[model samples]
Target: MRRLLRTTWANTVLLALVLSFVTTTAVFAKNLDVSLTELFPSDRQVKTTLVINKVLERFHYRRFQLTREFAAQTLDNYFEDLDINRLFFLERDVTRFISNAGQLHDQLQQGKVDIAFDIFRIYRMRVDSRIEYALALLDQPFNFSRDETYQFDRSKSAWPVNEQQLNDIWRKRVKNDFLTLRLAGKNDDEILKQLRKRYEGIMRRIHQFTVDDVYQTFVNAYIRTLEPHTAYMSPSTSENFDISMRLSLEGIGAVLGADNEYTVIQRTIPGGPARQSGQVRTGDSIVGVAQGLDGDMEDVVGWRLQDVVDKIRGPKGSVVRLQILPKAEGTASRRLREVTLVRKEIALEDQAAKSSIITIPTDAGAAQRIGVIEIPAFYRDFRAESEGNPDFRSTTRDVRQLVTQLKKQQVSGLVIDLRGNGGGSLTEATSLTGLFIRQGPVVQVKDAFGKIEVESDPDPDIIYDGPLAVIVDRNSASASEIFVGAIQDYGRGLIIGEPTFGKGTVQTLVDLNRYVPGDNTDLGRLRLTMAEFFRISGGSTQLKGVEPDIHFDLGIAGSDQGERSLENALPWSKISTASYTQHHSINNVQHLKARSAQRTAQESGFQMLMSRSRILSEIEAEDTVSLQEQIRRRESDQREQVLKEERHRFLRAQGIEPVDEDAESPDEEALEKQQKVIDKIQTRESAHILTDFIQMQWNTAYEQRTAK
Candidate 1:
């Protein structure tokens, strides 16, 4: 399962998932009596829901008690799930729902789910009213010169006080939508037509929502209230999850979710076409998708997320074109760009660890060749292993070979780049950690009942023990944290870059369909958080993650991007440190750090990266945009030009010539290769860091011999 960011909007957007399609565009009438009985969870579903709820209440690592407090939290979460932007439900509606919050626990215990349906009914009515008002607003011409701003992020704002207030909100929403299309180069008539279709699609999708859909959404809201990682996946979603885990699908390798009308990228799978293309990014909106190079673009803005995904997935070796609306830079508007990628099966080779040599400059007019191993994930072919394949693919096996090859090349130092490695098999993490160290405990696991299990290195032999560094970023998580933490604990290497993603809990998927007697229908699955990971140093890598010895602030850290940013995340704690020998200690890390700081201060590449971060932060913080088309276009173009200049300047400073301005744009293959080159700049810097480390080691050894 994809780990969702802590942003409420991101989670709520995912709830707008696969609703069964309906042909009719039913405009809901005010007096329509939508039956709550039909909208509630089925007997089997309710049975499964209750079973999982009980399990979480008792066996979850947090062991949260089922009390009125939890009940109220669940109630708040349900409202947020239904109407995160505070656009649909009124303050009165929320107040009325509060009276039912304290009774939710009792209701769930008895398997009475009328409350969810009742609240959903009110939400549906509100959506209908807003859609009607928004459509009516389009009838009047928008005043772009009014100098008004729309609060796009209203998740924290209070609900409108009255109908007129709500209408005013819709008025701005409609205007913003109009302005967005206009900025996208759409004319007045085309903008109106598209907006009308978008509103119609929203109504159609909501009307098509099944009882199972509503129940799944509400159950997930309840589950999330318990903990962010724990989740209930409906049967259909369970199948998709299995497919994702199997890595069998031939597609762009992106996890797509609905964000209002747009199908947004949730996460890009490692070794997938989307990730390889380097164009698709998290939060980018897929406005249009096309087949082949010359196929007509299919507008996907108002389509079902699953439908859009289907269009993107195809036979291996096929090309899919995506018209992307990048996440607005800060508060500025986004421009659309087209990216083409060839769909392919995400083979083991794609994610396997690879090695390269980077030459680090030295003071004596010499250079040290450092080996850089880029590990995208801690992956393993579980099926092959289960089938008794002796040569089963795994991260440790791949890296071991890469280290051997690098050693053959006579590289002076080593750096393992784990940035954006979200992690995979825990077994691989332990085994990989074993590669760089002698035998010892790699990580510890703590159960809900306080039983601690030590997972130790299976191999006593060290593969590569040269001067080493591990480069990580905010997306490095779970098993990545485990490996990096073990390295730190053992004094085996220096860690560089920002703190990791801090996801240390272990989750187990329970198939609910298995427990239902004689039920062949789709009974969902439950992902329950069962255990927490503790580093050998006694500290839990839960919320704190693994802090680097040398930190590089690429400006991506400290956002709502890690476990600590999550709501109700488990707190950091420590136990008795595992008894282990420190194979190698970095006594000169402070001196090395000082040298790195000096270089970073004067290095053009580092300074350029800092500038990029500042621009990104500014773009992210801007929640409002100017409605005037010319001003919006001018600001966007100016930002784009500035970014282009920064890129060229950085390249020139690195002694690499910038591409000719009038030259034809690179093809898909060239673009993918260029992405690899761009990614290696950091690796080059890491090699430099490792070079400093190696120099410090030699100096320390020489001084010790002289003193002796």
Candidate 2:
């Protein structure tokens, strides 16, 4: 229940649901006929579907079933899944499909899947016609001077009434594509070639989609209606899902899923090539992939997620180039970036807890030496532990070693930087919490059946009792939240930075083949949400993530991110607090807040970050862009320059050396490692914040000692 993409299948059906909203329902007199012959579902698919539905009914966190009300949701999910962009199916087609909304549940329960396939047939026909229109527009010269705007997000807009209206929309879409390339320095002929290839790629991919693809989409659409995290993987995607579960998989290290027509980056593995590259990010669209330094980019806009993943993965040490279309918050106009990464096996050494010592200058001549430990993840070697290996690798074990070293240096305070640390092993979280405080409950678990269990700290002795601060961000989630939440509840440390990613549920992977005996067929898997995690203080970290005691104004913080942003996510709730004694009290929280705010206002890095955040907000708020080529080009250049200048300024302020403009990295692997070093600088400012906190606490303690 962490901030994971949840197998290879969760959130795969989001766009479909978004585009399937009912704006104006119309009844059609046309008789739509469908039969099981058209579906051609395999025996495995039928059995898997039935078993998945049963699991959802019995063990899912959400208990609502395939009633008439839920059936309407299923129909909308189906229509939207088929035509997420609203470019293919006409208003009348949707109207004709509306009549079957109430009866879909009964038909599906009886193993009748003809409705989904029949609806898909109409969608295919519409796609063929639309592709022809889009292809025809590629030949015409567009008037760039016209001040016409294309609505990119048409989820709320009414569907096109006729073929003429739809053609007009496609014409604008093609022109916009041409203009984006033109601004990127492509000539007219080159633009035409690229656009034609891209459009044709879409057509080919649409036509090549197998029956399984339609079935998977429809089934996932239903699964998502139950909950955002519950998902059903197809036989082929199941293989990819299993591969994704393993940390040692040799690939680019980024999880991928379909978002409308694009393959979006879901989560970058903590020690993977993509995470180290600093070029690819969550929500970025991989539009094309190429091998080596100079290779032809394959247009992948309309390709399936499995196909995209296959192209990105290769032998270790090989380079893959990804054509990235960054996720624009509220606008459709986004610039493209190309990132190159050398594939490698994810090594545990790269993700181990790293320690550094910072000597912070305090009031007068006193100086405080603070220990900083950057924990990239809460990982534990389950196989090693299960085999009873004496030296099993885990966050708690690695951190203990680092703390021992820091203690030998006689550091006055400790800062556990959990920024980008998405949760891993829950046991590691509990054990790590044990390192700081005496034995107590670390977190609580509640199942759908209302059974509650409390996980304890699992240790009685405290190792380090000095002033501690835990730095977290929006990406800090699940097990991270459990640990951070415990620290705050026990009054053992100050929680710094943005709120944690609210993910408190527990998911178990159920193999469908297990239920159907004597079946050699691959029935895929179901990732079902069955339980929830809560803090020892009784507060649930579901939609409401753990709030920081000393909040920082980071760009991603306070934005519409985390569990609350997801649809059908569980609500926040509270239970009776666990019995635990407070470890220590800072006593001067207001003063600390005031002093930190004063310093942040004057800090050059923070100022630059705030400015860039404002620019991003403005960009997101914009509904239209100037169609004029010169205006568009100038705007793009200005935005890029501002960001570049701000980044350089921030780096200079942090006293970190910037990458040499003239010194290009020899290859992708070297560049990625270099980028990882650069990303670590951003955390330097957080270290400074922790230093300030320590100094403030030291001053207060020193004054109290003098008074005594």
| Candidate of highest lDDT | 1
Error of 1 at 501 (Å): 0.4
Task: Please provide, for model 1 over 1-708, each residue's C-alpha lDDT reduced to its tens digit, 9 standing for 90 to 100.
Answer: 112111221222123222211111112222233454467656766676677766776768897777777878888889987777787888898888777777788888776667888888777778788888888888998777777778877877887788888887778888888887787777899888878877876666666666766787888788888788887887766655554434444667776767555687866767787777667777778888889999977677656665666667666777778888866343355467788777777667877888889888887667999998889878777669879999999999999999999999999999999998877777788889998898999998887789888888867899987889999988798889999999998999999989898988877766676666677867787766778889998999998899999988666537566788788788889988887888877876777778887888877777767776777777666556776766777887777667668767877765666653212344545545545666776677778888887877777789999999
Q: What's each prediction's TM-score?
A: 0.90, 0.89
What TM-score does candidate 1 reach? 0.90
Angstrom error at residue 573, model 1? 2.3
Q: What is the C-alpha lDDT of each candidate?
A: 0.75, 0.73
- Superposed by TM-score, candidate 1 places the C-alpha of residue 75 at a distance from the truth, in angstroms, of 1.4
Q: Which candidate number would show the highest TM-score if scored against the true structure?
A: 1
Which pairs clash in the backbone of model 2? none
